[model samples]
Target chain A: MLRALRVASPLAVVALWQLASSLGVLDPSTLASPAQLARTAWELTRSGELPHAVAVSARRAALGFALGAAVAIAAGTVVGLSRVGDAVLDPLMQMLRMLPLFGLVPLFIIWFGIQEEPKIYLVALAVVVPLYLNLVAALRGVDRDLVEVARVLRLRRAEAVRHVYLPAVLPGVLVGLRQALGLAWITLIVAEQVNAGAGLGFLVNNARDFLLTDVIVVGLLCYAALGLVTDGVVRALEWRALRWRDGGETA
Target chain B: MTGTDLTTPVVAAAHGVRRAFGDHVVLDGVDLEIRRGEFVTLLGRSGSGKSTLLRIVGGLDQGAEGDVRTGTAPAVVFQDPRLLPWRRVLDNVALGLRGPDARARSTEVLDEVGLAGRERAWPRQLSGGQRQRVALARALVREPDLLLLDEPFSALDALTRISAQQLVRRLVDVHRPAVLMVTHDVEEALLLVDRVVLVDDGRIALDEEVGVRRPRRRDDPDLVRWRTRLLGLLGVADA
Candidate 1:
């Protein structure tokens, strides 16, 4: 019953929207009707424009997220593992973290040029802060008693990391990854808007220029779908990784 | 399992061990010894330093000033189960063991603890008593020369505590590791320990050998007498 309601809620809203469009209660210029949006999506699909744009946006998000997560994990591990590492790098990272990464799009464009580099750089920068912060916090939050267990068990350094620290940090890192994914999508949209592009943002911009509200809506629905899909994948990974956790619920 | 020789050698010996925290001393010039295959209990009040002494013997708190010699690194079962929440029951038991057959060895030990088919379960999936059983299994799987239990059953309910106590006694009889368990319960110390030592004001006040034979009952007159004596030492008036 609850699952049925969840499906019904979205359908109900769409139905109301379609009704409003039919009665002319809503303007066709600003908001596309469900039928119009569907026709537009089908047209773009047949013409191959939507797929091409989707490919471009998906690649950028994937590459940018991987780059950001890699750097953050490395830096977070270093700063978390040793007192000296924490003392050296954490302060500067904290200062950098306070800056709004979205505002750096213009700066990145100037530095790396108005191309793929700037767009990818924006997504990478957007995700790094939360990833690093969560990693550091999780590392520091490892149970002291568990560490003592490792000591008593005579687990060597590598074994301790593999069994103790890695497991301890994983749940927190996965949460951070999900948050970073959200930020990555927002940053990608904004970054794609700043310059001439061959991505979803470019498609939306072209549609807006031609007053193609249906096509613009299709572009946004694609973004929402991609976000949902990626989030679902991460949730599945978390479910498998945290099988030891109670409830056994997927994200 | 290796055959345990009762007269083989001393399992653990602590000589002039002293641990202090600034002005407050925990274990002050304490000396203790355990024979192979013996079950010893340290009974004391809340601040009696029984845990400090256990830590020193376990080689965990090296800040103590003294020497401790043991046949090998002692395995410890803490008050809490202390099993890694992320690992499955079998993995937690196999933590310290090595080699190709560690998984099979862990399975055997888990079964010995009477958790025959719960090897794949997580720590949280088990009850309080079951988790403690896993802790005992983890300690035993390593087959250490000495097993130090710091109030391992203190957190359990009355009925669960009795069953857990029985399990520990049975395991000790079979595996024959020199056991030094610290607890504040007089009845527990009398029921499980071959020898009971009282710690008071950073010293061993009474080290009495309980003359009761194996598998003694709680209502036995000898156990009753020892409980009265220990309670008196702890400043609790006899009922």
Candidate 2:
């Protein structure tokens, strides 16, 4: 019953929205109706424009996320594991994260040009903050008792990290992964806007010139879809990695 | 396990050991020794430095004020079990344990602890008693000369505690490692250990030999008398 209500609530809203559009209570130019948006989306998909934009956006997001996550994990581990590293690096990391990163898009374009470099860098910077913070917090929260166990086991530093630290950090890392993926999409949207070139942002920008509200709506929906898809992927990963997390012990 | 006689070689020894966390000293000038194939329990209240002493002896803590040495890096079973939740029962048991036979030995120890077929289970999937058993197996799989236990049974319920105790006692008999267990339970001390070292005011207040025969009863008069003495020493009314 609850699941049905959950599904029905969103459906009811869409139904109401479409009704408003059909009755001409809403203007398509002002705000495209759901049906018009769907038509535009289908037309764009058939012309291969939507697929090309999605591919371009995905490549940027994936590359930036990959680069950002690698650096964050490495730095988070260093700062998490060593006091000197924490003292030296954590404040620096926090400072970098605290900056209004999006505001730097102008400077980034000037420095790296309004090329792929600036956009990818913007997305990477956006992805870095969330993953790094979550990872550090998770590492700090590791069971010290298990570290003692690692010591007693006579595991080498690397072995201890592999068996103890890595697994312990996984849940937090997955949480970060979800956040970073979401941010990567948001960052890419703003990034591709500056370039006014190939990507979902370009499609939306191009539609605005011709007042193609339905096509712009389609682009917006694509961005939201990208966010949901990445989140779903991370959620699936979390489900697998944390299957051993406490639910209830066998009696 | 029935502990061996005093003639056996000492597996671990500590002298004038001291530990302080910032301003507070936990273990002060504490000296203790455990013979091979012996079972010793450090009897102390919370904050009495029994665990601090154990950590020092187990090589988990460093920068102590005095000498502490063990024949080999000791195996420890903490109250929390400390099994990696990500590792299955068998992997946890085999962790950091080297040799081509490590996996087989881990299986044997799991069976010895009565967890024969549950090797594939995750640590979080086990009950508290079962998890503690896995921790014990993890320690025993190493075949260390010294086993350090930090209140290993304090987490279990009454009935499960008894079973876990029996399992430990049986494993000690089979493996014959020198065991140093820290606990506040006087009855537990009397039931399992060959000697009880009372820790008080950050020192060894008393190191009395139990000298009781194997399979001691909880209500045994000798044990009762010692419990009363210990309770009094711990400043209990013993009413």
Candidate 3:
């Protein structure tokens, strides 16, 4: 009940703002009441423009996040397992990770020419560092005693990895994915604003130029809604994947 | 017994086993022979390297020196139950088994350990004693010729420890694995082992045989005598 109230409180505030604006107590042109934003969002949805923009942004974010996470996890595992791999790649990765994704926008635009390639590359760059760091830490945190038990059982290297290491590192990987998802969305918005021909970010940018507060409000709300939806999907998948983890009880 | 074959000794010999971690020598030229169906407890103080020796015997560690020649691979139970948290009780028990027979073997072992109805229970849901029983089941599932127990019941409460010890005794009687348990508890050592080996300064100081019969009472005169001797050998003043 408390959780539901907390969620409803924000919407209630928006409703109150709309009512106050409709009563002429507040300027709708400056603030753009919730009702106005809703009407604008409905029109955009009916015209299929909003849906197309959302589809493009979602595809770009999903593809970039998946590719980045996969590569980072593989690289992190190699770096964690071998001393040579760690020594050779650790310093280089640390340097690259320190470089901000937005700071590389100009170079990305120059290289990829303001196309979808640059925007996707920006999203990947934003996500890879956190995923890599989390995966490496997780791999290092694998229990030595568990490995010893596997050795005593005479488990083959592959069997040990499958039965022990994978399960042990899963929680850490999920944490990274959660963090990466949020960053991917934020990066997608920024990349779209700068280079995207179509997206929620492009819509918001277009509204700003025309002083269309309703469109701007609608775009921002859609971004928040998209973030919530993606996070929900990831969390649901995490719960399903780690069902053996104390029956989905949060630790 | 139908499956009893007592002609050959289970663990052949431990010849001049010397283990050292850098400057500190844990086991120094230790030689011992464990015969089939013998409950030999290695009693020592903390850091006396009895656990280290047990690890070497269990094939979990390689000694700095010496060779352990055995008839078959041993199954070990650590002080911690070491059950995989993600695995069910039966799956944890089946950890040591191979191929398709693992599930049936695990169920049988769980039944033998008096946990017949707890095959689907998770490790976290089990009590300390029950977890150790699962660990025992895991070892027994392999049908190992030698069972190496590294203070398996030490972490449990007194009541739980006693019951677990009794369970181990029953399992040993039925399966007849050559058992070597390392423990710091002298009374627990006296209660469980057929022969007690006192280790001090990285060497076996005393190897005494218990003449008392099965289900021996703690207050037995024979046990009292052996305990006194063991305490003296361990440099503990008699109470």
True contacts kept of each: 0.56, 0.68, 0.22
lDDT, model 1, position A101: 84
- Candidates, DockQ: 0.46, 0.55, 0.37
| Pairs that clash in candidate 2 | B1-B169
- Candidate 2 lDDT over A1-251, as tens digits, reads 99999999999999999999999998888888898888888999999999999998888898888889888988998998889999999999999988998899999989998767888888889988999999999999999878877877889999998999888999888888888888899899989887757889899999999998998889998999989988888888888778777544342
Sorted by lDDT (best first), the order is 1, 2, 3
Considering DockQ, which of the candidate structures 1 and 3 is the better prediction for this target? 1
Q: Model 1, range B126-163, lDDT digits (tens) per residue?
A: 89999999999999999978999999999999999999
TM-scores for candidates 1 onward, in order? 0.93, 0.90, 0.93
Model 1 residue runs over 4 Å out of place are: A19-28, A247-251, B1-7
Candidate 2: clashing residue pairs, number: 1
Off by over 4 Å in 2: A1-27, A31-36, A246-251, B1-7, B16-30, B202-205
Leading candidate by lDDT:
1
Share of native interface contacts present in candidate 2: 0.68
Q: What alpha-carbon RMSD in Å does predicted model 2 have with respect to the real structure?
A: 2.8
